[model samples]
Structures are given as C-alpha cells and as structure tokens.
Target: MSEHQRAMLNHIREVNQHIENLVTDYWKAYSGIDTWQFWLNAVLLIIPLVFLLIYIDRRRVFQILFFGYTIHVLMNYLDITAVLKGLMYHPYSLLPMPQSHLTLDASLIPVAFMLTYQLGYNRRINQYLLAVVIGAVMSFIFGPIVHAIGFLKMYHWMSYWVLFIGDIIEYIIAYWLTSFFFHFYRNDEPTS
Candidate 1:
C-alpha cells in the first residue's frame, strides 16, 4: 500500500479507538443487563430495521439507506459525547454503551421520515420544510408518546424542544449529505 493509504488507515484506527473509549467510559455508571435485557434491546433495535428494509425500495433505496447510515454514525457518536457531557439522557441500553441495540433514536423511524420527504417531494426546500414539520411532530407528539412509555425518559435541563433540535440537526445534515451523494451518483442520468 501507498504511504498515504497507511497513514489514513492509522488515522482511522486512532479515531475509532477514541470513539470506543469514549462510549465505554460514558456508560460506566449506568446499569446494564447481561441476560434478558441484552436480547430485548437487540430485538427492539433489529425488528424495526428489518421491517423498514423490507418495505422501502428501488432507485432511491441507496439514497435513503446511505444517508440514514451516515446520520446513524454521526448521531450515535455525538450522542455518546452528549450523554457523557450531560446534554441528553436515556433509560435503556442493549450493550454497555451509550446507544440502544435497536438504535431507534438513530435509525429506522428517522429514515422512514426521510423516505417520506424524498418520495413526496422533488425539491430540496420542500424536504427541509418537511423536516421541520416532522421535527415538530416528534417534539410535540412522538416525544410525549415515547416519554409515556418507559422506553424513553428525559432528565437534566432537557425538553421536547431539545429532542426536536436533535431531529432538525439530523435531518438537515442527512438531507444535504444525501443530496450531494445523489447528485453525483445520478449525474449521468436525466430526471423528469
């Protein structure tokens, strides 16, 4: 391999290790289960994901999936930092980390929302507006629903608005990032 490749690999490894260390330390004080909860969290996270993949589709699949995955990575990493720093809180975990197994916060539902925006509108402005709408719904509606369930709980100077802010940030980042990739990926073709 080239010198540049080797250096890049080393940098990536360093960054990954840093992330793992951060995640580990952040959950050090939190209660985690070794048996039933592990399976429960894993099942909760994976079930929705499986359903989403089975239902969503086609020429736009990659755009949605790729963007969601990118958002997932960024959201999870940031969430790890945020929780450690007291910016957010959750009451469950699938692993001994800051993220849940189903990763619902970072996956499936948000991706489904993105798919809706992507399919329902062809304009970027429209998508942004839609994201705002969805953010509102999440803050005003879904927030209470999940909070009502033990699946989610809030603490330490946080509110539904904070949840909405996270949604807006996630959607905005995902939209633009996905758009850039889609533009290049579909550049050779013409859209009507």
Candidate 2:
C-alpha cells in the first residue's frame, strides 16, 4: 500500500480502539447487568416480543414478521448513524459495550410497529394514518419517558420532533416494501 493508505489505516484503527475503550468504561460505570437501567432495557427488549407472539394473527404471521424486520433494519441504520454522529445515545443497555440502542431498535420499536401494521392491514385502516399515530406515541410518549428515566440522552442538535419524523418515514418505507413483496408473491402464484 501507499504511504497515505497506510496512515489512513492506522488512523482508523486508533479511532476504533478509542471507541471500544469508551464503551468498556461506560458499561462498567452505568450500563452493566447489575444496574436497574439494564433490567429496564431488558424488559423493553423482551416484553413486546412476548406480546407479539401472543396476539399476532396466525394466518398473517409471516407478513407481519416481514414488516417488522424491515422496520428493525431501517431503525438500526438510522440509530447507528445518530449514535455515531453524537446526536443521541442510550445510557443503559441490556448488553455491555453496546454500540447502539439495540433493545429498542431490534425489539420494542419493531414489535410495536409490527402490531400496529397488522391492525391496520386487517381492519383496512389507512396505513399512513396509523403510522402517524404510532410514530407520535413512540416519539412523544415513549421517548420522553425513556429520557426522563435516564435511559436515553440527546445532544442539543436532536429533538423528539426529529425522531418522530424519522419514525414515520421508516414506517412508511417498510409498509411500502412489505406491500410490494406480497403483491409480487400473489401475482406469481401458480394457476390451478
């Protein structure tokens, strides 16, 4: 490699190591399993999943799962960007050295979105309208509660309104993507 390439590699390695050290220190001081905050995050991660299992429509389970997975993937990407940009962060996590808001991004948020989408689909409710209501609840209600309880922190650049917008956008995208796939599948079905 050229000298410039070698220097860039070294710089990246240094940055990664610095981040890892910070995560380790942060975990020991605030986010470890011994903390109540950790338990709260654990509950946030698991309870929604249990509820989804109990209440999900068995006939449409796969469809809902796909929608939820889309939301989870999109949220993770957005959250990781926010964390890396120093816009927002989780103060406590179910796992040590967590890089992003895994509990919320992977579980609670996705499950909530999934159930709401299912409801909207089954009832023939306007999906965009449902997205707005659920997004508001997540951004205005749940976000504030988590922040108040010291589970989430935000820098001056971030606001709950921005989060609400982000949630709505992701929800819409996931809904469209899921719909597209199912439409394609139905059209591709073999004739008798």
Candidate 3:
C-alpha cells in the first residue's frame, strides 16, 4: 500500500477503536441501572447548566427558575400528550419521569434563550424582538433537526410547524413571565 493509504487506514482504525471504547463505557454504566443514580445523574447534569446561568448573572436566580418552570410545566404537558399520541418519543432517559427530556426543554434551553436576550439588550423592544428570532429558529430549524436525529422522534406530524409552534409558544410565555416578573418585582436583583 502507498504511504497515503497506510495513514488513512491507521486513522480509520483509531476512530473505530475510540467508538468501541465509548460504546463499552456506555454499556458498563448502564448495565445495572440504579433507581437513585437515575435522579442523581440528572442532578449532576443540572448543576452545571445552572452554573452557566449564574455565571451569566448572579442576580437572576428566581427569575431563571420560575421562568424555566413556566416552560417546563407547559412543555411537559405536551410531552405527555405527545407520547400518548405517538407524536413524540425518547430512546433514553435518566429518570422514569413522564417526559424524560423535560429538564432541558423546559428548564434549560428556553431559560437560556431569554437570559441571552436580556443580557444583550436592556430594553423591552429589543428583548422581545430577539426572543421571536430565537424562538423561530428553535422551532423551525433546531426542533426538526433534533427530531430527525432521533434525540426527538415525532409521529403523525409532518408539517414541522408543530414543533415550531411549540417552541414559539413556549418562548413567548416563558419570556413574557420572566420579563414581567423582573419588571414588576425585579426578582433578579441581587440581595444585599
């Protein structure tokens, strides 16, 4: 074989070996799942996501959680219904919760989106405008791509707008609540 072919073969072999190791480690971790570990792992993952928000701004703790919860409750409701209708599914979940993906969808992503909006702009008009753009991208682009990638699976829905509507509605409500709470109560103000 030529020198080029030899190097290509070596690279492919290395990639395959790495993939094998990852799969083995995954199976080992999942071989015997424990009830506590399920929740624990989720807690562990959530800690860092929270830290990201705090790192962005320490004052916004209550605003973040409450706004996130707003999205969480609504999205989880849809998730349960979707699962029952075979409109959505997850192949894996740490928790046996009705909707395993609730943590990210409801708590993390939407919160982050709103936070990013506010962080970049202090005025209401800018925040709302940015939110709509973010929401549309989330619903139209990211949502369908995730569904195609099997992180999300949808059934009985081909319009793609279904996911888009969910994202748009979610961001609107979550952003609205977070914004109102902050404007009226200034929940994000850091305590003395």
lDDT of 2: 0.90
**Residue 114 displacement (Å), model 1:** 3.6
Candidate 2 — which residues are off by over 4 angstroms?
Answer: none
Better of 1 and 3 by lDDT: 1
Q: Give the TM-score ranking, best first.
A: 2, 1, 3
Off-target runs (Cα >4 Å) in candidate 3 are 1-51, 106-108, 120-125, 183-192
lDDT of 3 at 17: 82
| Residue 175 lDDT, candidate 1, scale 0-100 | 78
Global fold similarity of model 1 (TM-score): 0.67
- lDDT by residue (76-155, candidate 1, tens digit) is 77666667677555665655553543455555455656565655444444777777888888778877875675556666
Query: Model 3 RMSD to the real structure?
Result: 16.9
- Model number with the top TM-score: 2
User: Tens digit of lDDT per residue, candidate 2, span 1-192?
Assistant: 999999999999999989888888888788887888878888888898899999999999988999999999999899888888889888787766646577898899999999999999999999999999999999999999989998789997799999999999999999999999999988998999
Q: Which sections of candidate 1 miss by over 4 Å?
A: 1-40, 98-102, 121-125, 188-192
Give candidate 2's TM-score.
0.95
